[model samples]
Target: MRHITSALLLSGSLLSGSALAECQNTGNFQQWLNSFKHQATASGIPANLVNNALHNIQYDPSVIELDRSQNTVSQTFLQYAANKANSYRLTNGQRKMREDRPLFQRIERQFGVPAPVLTAYWALESDFGNVTGNVQTLRALATLAYDCRRGSFFHNELMHALRLIQRGDIKVPEMMGAWAGELGQLQFIPSSYNKHAVDYDGDGRRDLIHSRADALASAASLLRQYGWQSRQPWLVEVKVPVQMNWALARLGKKLPVAQWAKQGVTDVSGRPLRTSGNAALLLPMGRNGPAFLAYPNFDVMLRWNKSTVYSTSAAYLASRYAGAGQVRYGNAPIQVLSVAQVKQLQSKLRARGLRVTKIDGIIGEETRRAVRLVQQQMRLPADGYPDLTFFQKL
Candidate 1:
């Protein structure tokens, strides 16, 4: 018997089909899963459920590779927005919105989330249900849960996936999803689906994969649960005055839209955003790139996807779907930073007495704030985006 430790197992769950070939050390992986089955049963998961789900599950090394290869700081917001909300995606999303108008409206009446935003999320996450990945959810979860790097998190997700199966929400054999066990066309992880999925089509099951109604309603329910406000704009592209105050470029400070108008923030067409409520300014790329006034609903979308790129892109796509034009941006070449490079940048910011709470090589809020301070000192727009020039100057 080959005794295997999870520490030796790789991370990464199959988000893509290519991960099938990535699983190595099958003997050790099987041994680990076998041992984990006992633990799963001890934790109250039925022994039959554990055996049925884990017996035939294979280890996926591609999941681990993809997980470890994630460079959170690699893509700039502008790049992400452009790619995710490209012309093809936008056009397809608009068609999806039009075709599903009645359904969307009905969801809105019940959930208070706009159709455009929901459609945008669908388009971004799974390309409007065209490509929901070909990985088995159970296999991915089993491999990820056994992998030591993210064992606890994936273990919980695996248990949730098992419960979803046991509860008959979906069949065990037919459970396919992203590499990381995100089920259905919306790419929801198992726990999210269990919590937010709804049987909107009235077929008696919350089928996020084959049922558009279920997926959209589930997404809307999640937004509504996260406090989505009806008919509120998530974001609006704005033109900042050249001689503006740089201090206000900091994120998370919500001032009234009227105040932003007073500060000379105008829409792309040189008009006020014409919206109510307080908003925060987001310079996705530095000042040289586009700016937007993010509303509270933007925070709701942020909860949907924590990445600034994902949130901003979803908002941008939603705005377009709602008859808004493309955002105006200057042509600036963005440099992709490796994890090591970002870690070095974090260290430099720390050396300069700036507070970068985590030197994790991820450009998080604290890192962005520190970057803004550096830009303010250098008189370089204070947008907080660490572009090529900013990095070179530093």
Candidate 2:
């Protein structure tokens, strides 16, 4: 298993300057990059390859901007859904699916990755290749690697990116992508490209850049590697009980389908819960919004992206395009709190020894479990919602 974590850059922003001073983009950026490049060459990378890559390298400010922006995105599922499933996007998605039928079909046959999943990822990541970002891969990866927080990881990623250029799979200038260095039709990071990409077109290259065959196949390979069950659906929209505890829904609490049926959870059409696998109760919106009983495949998407809303969107969109029925969200407004405040409350809870697992401000499984534990310890009812009352007490 490729034990993935956030790029080391995030660790730098954690403690302020930390160890980044060593690789910070001071005036010595070029010098350090040259030395870094030499070490890369000494480690079996070609010197000409390093010179060819470093010669055109320029610092990318946008990567830093996007790196910062990831933490501040809104929590509303609709906001995310509207952005992901917009009209222009849907139109373009259909067009791409039709135009690239043979390539997509070939990829699906080989990788067992459904076309809709590939289509969804394609449309979402780079807008079906229309809006692939134009950032230098070397600089983006190198700058991130040297950023002290996640330098080691990014440095390794930078090496893989340079290797792509060396292997002649993609031109250095054409290796553009998201600010984080994810490339081609599906937004795969450099490390992912090295690990999962395939030469589906048989052109003697794992050409994700200009070939839909390779890109879609590569995406499918990634999902399969991540344990996608081709025979299974991604997630099923479910009927949640009225007066159900919203806090409990977000905890990734798993119960048998029969147990859920006994408690009023049902299929989207109000049928009995299908007892095939243990389902996790998920509520992206608040108490009044739509709820889903997500299955194992849902966790697969989380492995790709840690965000709940992102994986939810991928599952929902994939199912939607795959002929799944639309779902109706009810009237619950998930509590709106800024990112910073969430962190503040979490830090306070940590100080009180409540075990708010990760320090990130988001109230994920760990934080909610910590909340429930604190509530029980305080001789209070253990609802896992973080409220102003909890903040004030902290």
Candidate 3:
């Protein structure tokens, strides 16, 4: 899954009526399945394989319910980070690295991605593959493909899943994984499995579900494909000057490390910031919380999972696995906004002629940008974070 966090936050809105009529169905599931089978076979998938893979597939309403119930807005940065990068994960990740030293060294040399980064992802994505979800992959994909909200995306994923089955990578009955059609230890969706999966163990098939070598190596390969630089830093916990302009703390505003140092940014110990490349000052919980200098490789983490909370936690966890200490919280406690409050804040921003696409109560990138704009106008620290005080001002 390219953006696993975003994939879980799939919008619940239905497709346009014409589009819904073409794919969405409850009672007409059989007819839609037949049509999809015909299309699959016409696309050169062996007809018998298609039939066997999709046999006895029924519409799964539970998948739709789970999809609609997902929400990540209520979580504060600290709350989300603590949950994803807790001590349990850190310990297990270190152990995994030690257990597979030779394999990790080979992958690092070939793909330029550190073992800790892949280990952090594995720890978070599936708890070191202990809980890869019990949902039937074909059933979930078929049900989602027939749903109107994200039918086209899931439909394409379902087709790729069929191709995986045809390629002898996995048998139809053994294809069980996440509710979002993700498979294996790293929770790769069908398309990613087809694109970047590698048989590092030389086992003939790229089996991410059962083989640790394949899963870990494939994850490194995927990161390398997403522009992961060898021997480059992804994130560094830092201290930001209280008097500096908070508007500069944004993911898009990358400045040279020297420039940031000239502007009063420093390492956690108040030492000069020392790095060769540009880095953005990422204030995940605004100016009053833990801060970091996110390097170019950090953007690659975002490509893996769009949510800042997830990416930051994964990066931080990777850092801890590499022997970094605990993160230091800022002077004041961060005020987290509720979903209702965020909706109200979005409405207020809209009334002030700010560009907020939807009042979905989610603190996505767009909402954060609009919040920053409003903060800038009000002569407040424009850190792009929403809180009760910001809401009251709006």
TM-score per candidate, chains pooled: 0.85, 0.83, 0.93
Question: Tens digits of per-residue lDDT for model 3 on 1-394?
Answer: 2224332322223222223223345557788889999999999999999999999999998988776654443566787778777778877889999999999999999999998899988988888988787899999999988887787888888999999999999998789988888788988888889999999999899999999999999999988988999999999999888778788889999988888888788888998877768989998888888999999999999888766777888899999998888898975778888878888998888888888867766687778999999888888888999877888888
Quality of model 3 by C-alpha lDDT: 0.83
Residue 241 lDDT, candidate 3, scale 0-100: 82
Best by TM-score: 3
Candidate 3's TM-score: 0.93
Top candidate, metric lDDT: 3
Q: List residue ranges in candidate 3 displaced over 4 A.
A: 1-27
Collision count for each candidate, in order: 7, 5, 1
Each model's lDDT comes to: 0.76, 0.69, 0.83
Off by over 4 Å in 1: 1-28, 42-44, 330-344, 353-364, 377-381, 387-393
Full-model lDDT, candidate 1: 0.76
**How do the residues 1-394 of candidate 2 rate in per-residue lDDT, one tens digit apiece?**
1111222221222222122233344556677787888888998888988888778676666666555445523355666776677667666767777788888777777767777778887777666766666777777887777665566767878888888877878887787766667678776777778888888889999988788778888888888888887666667788776755444565367767676777677787777766577777776654456777787778777776665666677777777767666557654444555668888878888898776655666666666677767766665535565655565665
Location of the lowest summed lDDT over 10 successive residues in candidate 1:
1-10
